[model samples]
Target: MATFETEFLFVYGTLMSGVDNQWSLRLWRACGQPSEAKVPGRLYTLGGYPGMKDPLDGEAAWVHGQLAQLPDSPALLADLDAYEGDEFVRLRRTATLRDGRIVPVQVYMYQPEVDENQRIWSGRFTFAQ
Candidate 1:
């Protein structure tokens, strides 16, 4: 199984504010320096949900999310898969944030390319917005 080395996940999706969501507080007990803040990357709305894309790409946009210093990224990725209905796949990617710092981040990608009409978004993000 592919595992991620970082604890921070750049969530630019429904997991943000308003829409509806949150990680278990129990899980947060072990979650580290999520306190380290960085508005790193651009957010885009696909369908109705947010998509964290490449900042270099002119098409990229940004939204709000959080920098969670999770201790276990692989487990977190698993939880994310389930949270996203077991279909969302995590891809290890690099993102350059609005602050000009580059960091290695994990992004979850949902397959089959959901259409705009079917996409549901929270509008407020924890990362890019």
Candidate 2:
């Protein structure tokens, strides 16, 4: 089985700072500061939010996002899980921090079918756009 040594989460969408997702802000408040990170994947728009398809298939590129440490609370984790719903499935993966450090992080990957037309070619997901 895969194990995670740190409680970090790689967020590429609404869970990011300055987004309208207040729940994410509250969760971030309970954790560490957000740090820039990169994951091998492609970001796609799912109407209101974004999802990432990892391992970068032949046509996709690396995804730009933020990595935040999660608090050591099972309740918080549960809350996050519930918030993510069935649309995404959490998994442990390695991400590259802005400082070039590699760390294991929990990434919520999209579970539903993704249309090639919704792919975010910029490799970055943001609400401001």
C-alpha TM-score for every candidate: 0.56, 0.88
What lDDT score goes with residue 122 in model 2? 91
Tens digits of lDDT, candidate 1, 53-128: 3344553334345455557546656766677664456767654555766677766654454445532243344333
Residue 93 in candidate 1, Cα distance off native in Å:
2.0
What is each predicted model's overall lDDT from 0 to 1?
0.51, 0.81
For candidate 2, lDDT tens digit of each residue in 9-91?
A: 89888788666566777777887578899988878988878988875457546889888888777777777778889878888
RMSD of each: 5.3, 2.3
Candidate 1 segments exceeding 4 Å error: 14-27, 32-58, 73-76, 116-129
- The per-residue C-alpha lDDT of model 2 at residue 89 equals 85
By summed lDDT, the worst window of 10 consecutive residues in model 1 runs over 118-127
